[model samples]
Target: MIDLMGYADRVWTGQEDLRPYFSGALREDGLLPVADGVWMWAATGNVYVFRTAGGLLLFDTGDRHTSRALHTAVRAVTQDPLHIAVFSHGHVDHVLGMDPFDQEAAERGLPRPEVIAHRHVPRRFERYVLTAGYNSAVNGRQFRAPGLKWPTVYRQPDTLYDQQLDLREADTQVLLRHGMGETDDATMAWLPDRRILCCGDFYAWNAPNAGNPQKVQRFVAEWSQALHWMAGLGAELLLPGHGVPIAGAERIRQTLLSSAALLDHLQQSVLELMNGGLTLDEVLHRVRVPAEMLSKPYLRPTYDEPEFIVRNLWRRYGGWYDGDPAALRPAPRAELAAEVAELAGGPQALARRALLLAKDGDLRLAGHLAEFAALAAAPGSAEHAEAHQARAQVMESLAADSPSFMAKSIYGWAASQSQAASRGEEPGKEEAGWAP
Candidate 1:
């Protein structure tokens, strides 16, 4: 067994939840045996293979880029054909690894593995097809990997279930239950005989990703309830999608429950502020989770920040108004910037003030002031150059301080744009997709 105490000390440094993983020795193709017959392949998204008497059962096949590596890893374990493959959700990373497995099976004169997932997966595929280029561009910026393209080819699932699915492979009983969490089509697997629960992205080592600023609306209430249900199962071994597995019944239960409590706290806190007629910005400042809960190893905000979660809750319960009349029908950004600059004397003055704000560590306010200066100043002007440089510095600082990879990606992209503008280049618009 890996030394838990030493591993924890190396992995958890109280700064970033996943910094240890990136700095550690785990390679993309490395496979770790979590149990006797179950093994996990670590990558952008993990793949868990269960070697049953009938054949191999796979849960969440990694990303498309890691397909060959995944195939090599699986072949190292067993040559038994893949009898069944289940998608944990409709995300691109979880579903695109099917082609490699299918290709290998075809070469061996074997039938393709039967794919299974929730009913909503087909719709998700349709949406991906509709917005293939758009999703590709957003993901490129999100991961800071320029020109990363999303494939138009999707392997549709053969078996689709609504809420619950039960299958018997040899003597192993596999139960698939639908839970609304990171995605609407999220599925969690439970093995009764082995007492192992494979939770997809629902339980990451970092904080819950339900509050992603760039993603769709996550079901927070249902997600919290799902955690409670998983905790009640009394599973001895818990396998998550992105991180190491947890052994021992009590440890698994507490980890799950603590994660759920964090969600519950965010949900309740957001609702309390919304019911009091506070605006989204006001509620963002007011709703706060306890430091103790935030300090939990599994509850660190390394992917989704709490503020974004509050905005999602507002979108669900309070609608799109955000309780701010100015945002209902805002003026054109350039026009507003010109007006603000005029009121502040000139664009040069605004640029100077922005630099001062950035120096004072008010990055958020500095960003706004710098944008106004940039928009108001003429192209190739000294004020325009100064404004862009200040904005770039502010964005870089924010990116460096952020623990969330998503936040760092966006802020880094913003910094790049500002830097380009300072060079007098017409920086292209940010193609980041709209969050639903």
Candidate 2:
């Protein structure tokens, strides 16, 4: 039942009412209510605009249109040109929009703004392009899409630092701390003056994306430690790369503590499982968020589920080869699919059972049954509607369950598809694929 979406679980049960409380913002970037006049852009990435003794500083350049909003937000407060642009560890979403700033400055006949990043950022981009195929396929699974593409061109960073750098500008005294959590080149900028900590990807609104089930190695223990250190920052306001900002000293500390505890539990649990020599299935069966931990509103498992996090812990500590010998010399997937179909008494039988499960209030399991039914559907079989409806039911319930930014996007896409089927319309052009 838990294997329907291949990895999604029933961790969201009886949690429908929690959906509407999401404070996700629509715009890419805007102002942060903390520190009085500070502004931030909360995109699929995080961007911070800082006013210092020198001039304007842009931390993380968000996706393409970010500069327009940055300009607007900055002008409303100050008329200074951007003195420096910081790269929050160069994942494309955070840096691609630097061109806009460059263009804006060029129009005024100013210098191409200084772009600062850790020395490894440029190397990461290079690796991204060089291993585009690996990234595409891994991203496909992580995002739940079958086929996705990676970026073509990559750029090197201008101002690169090797270790830590202390930022002292405008009354803001910040410590730029580095680590290997979500990314090897990750950084968390701590401002002691305002007691504000700008945690890039190390600490986001969601569960740490450390175990993305896709790209490179994720340092789980280190990620947990980084959060531990962040909790000690005496931060009154916590601004992340994604989701709403968290303000208040106690709230900030509590959020970080809970996040760190969650990771520690996951890391510690997986290590115990490994020590006990438990299989993956056995380990997954035992994964649990301690009652006290899950009770925290900020620590809810809405966006990134705990199972994936567990598997990520397994990977980080044990390496990619999950030690399944058959996987090393496996039969073709199509052949395996046919064998499984035969064993299950054909696709029709699976579809029928799926419809039954769905009728019995097991929407998650129904999705798998419906998929197999759809895949096994004979061309021109009227069973198409049956499978489609099962998928729709699962999606609708999913929407009501969490409605996190990702969930809403998927729910909306699934709804549009169902509506199309009813109206005899062609597939939606913006068919929401996975978040690769």
Candidate 3:
């Protein structure tokens, strides 16, 4: 068995890299005891188990893919009936693993665990059902998993609270508070007696995922506020929705506050620029998280980048109008591409220039020029194939250069599409099979 606590201690002290913990590579197949009576099963999402005289309390069941495994692991540790399963949010990964638990209760003639979450969780489920197809496509593009399907059927919360709910299982006291962060329906569970905090996706080991480009709006300012709120609680043990458990009160405090500071800086900077009558583009270029903050191992932009966070802040405050009058009612992309190609001496010239720009490490400009060339050229023509090949190379370069998972996935998808176009095959036809 891997000494997860020792590993976590090494990671917290900077003696070990956080990648193993973050990727769940160090996770054992069974529940790992985190405290005297607290156990955590780390999967794609972390499932925390709290043993009490009443029963067992859980925070954020594992994802659908690991649901059965999680149940088996939890059962291996204890036969205690599940008392309450608290969903940190409505995201499928955090809430979909209750099926096996529910089955166990039925087979054993025990009462089903009461599901609890914020009031907005059901609304989030409804929205998921409404945008099932769009969610499927975007998630597929984000994770680089072709033909990924979004689950419309959700395990709704049996009990919902607006602000806070407190529960007592014998001597233990668990406080559930609603907060807006990565998702509006986020719940933070506090175990006062044990001085442990079950913070959902709010404090994932990587940078705060407040600006996932492919998802719904995230609350940046509110997210920082929630982090600050958690920091103030003086948690001795931090059990996050993902990653290994963090020990030590001061270490937990510093980690939470540092993450909070990064988000606060970005939010305030964006707000300051937005208040100054700057356009979204101008604000995006001006606002930046400090290099020192990004250097923090826990705040690295491995999943979501700071630039995307700035854009999300703008979207939250400035709405869809990016202050670009031309963008307010833009010309058809193909028409504009044709006009630009004509100015540049045809699609062939544009493609050659794009390849040249790519060679010079100007991937952003190269991508634009290559895409325009491909759009302007006649379909099935030699020029079209040349332009698409250029586009594919540029996109692949962009993917290679990106440190963020989201950016890399998107650029990779774009490259895949361009590769198909270059081969004279229909783009996105492979993806159509999974469309709702």
lDDT of 3 by residue, 1-436 (tens): 6777888888777799867766766555588888898888887888898898999989989889989888888888898899899999998888999999888889999998899999999999999999999888888888777778889898888999999999777778999998999999899999987899999999988889988887879998898889899999999999988877899899899989998998889988998989999999899888877789989888889989999999888889989999999999999888999999999999989999999998999988898998899889898889988988888898899999987999999888888887888888876733443101
Scored against the true structure, residue 75 in model 2 reaches a CA lDDT of 64
Which 10 consecutive residues of model 2 have the lowest summed lDDT?
1-10
Q: What's model 1's overall lDDT?
A: 0.82
Ranking of models by lDDT: 3, 1, 2
lDDT of 1 by residue, 373-401 (tens): 87787778887787778777877878888
- The alpha-carbon RMSD values of the candidates against the true structure, listed in the order shown, are 3.0, 7.7, 2.2
Q: Ranking under TM-score, best-scoring first?
A: 3, 1, 2
Give the range where candidate 1 is weakest over 10 consecutive residues by summed lDDT.
427-436
Q: Please name the candidate that would achieve the greatest TM-score relative to the true structure.
A: 3
Estimated TM-score for each candidate: 0.93, 0.78, 0.96
State model 3's lDDT.
0.87
Candidate lDDT scores, in order, read 0.82, 0.65, 0.87
The residue pairs in collision within model 3 are: none
lDDT computed for candidate 2: 0.65
Candidate 1: where are CA atoms >4 Å away? 1-20, 23-25, 428-436
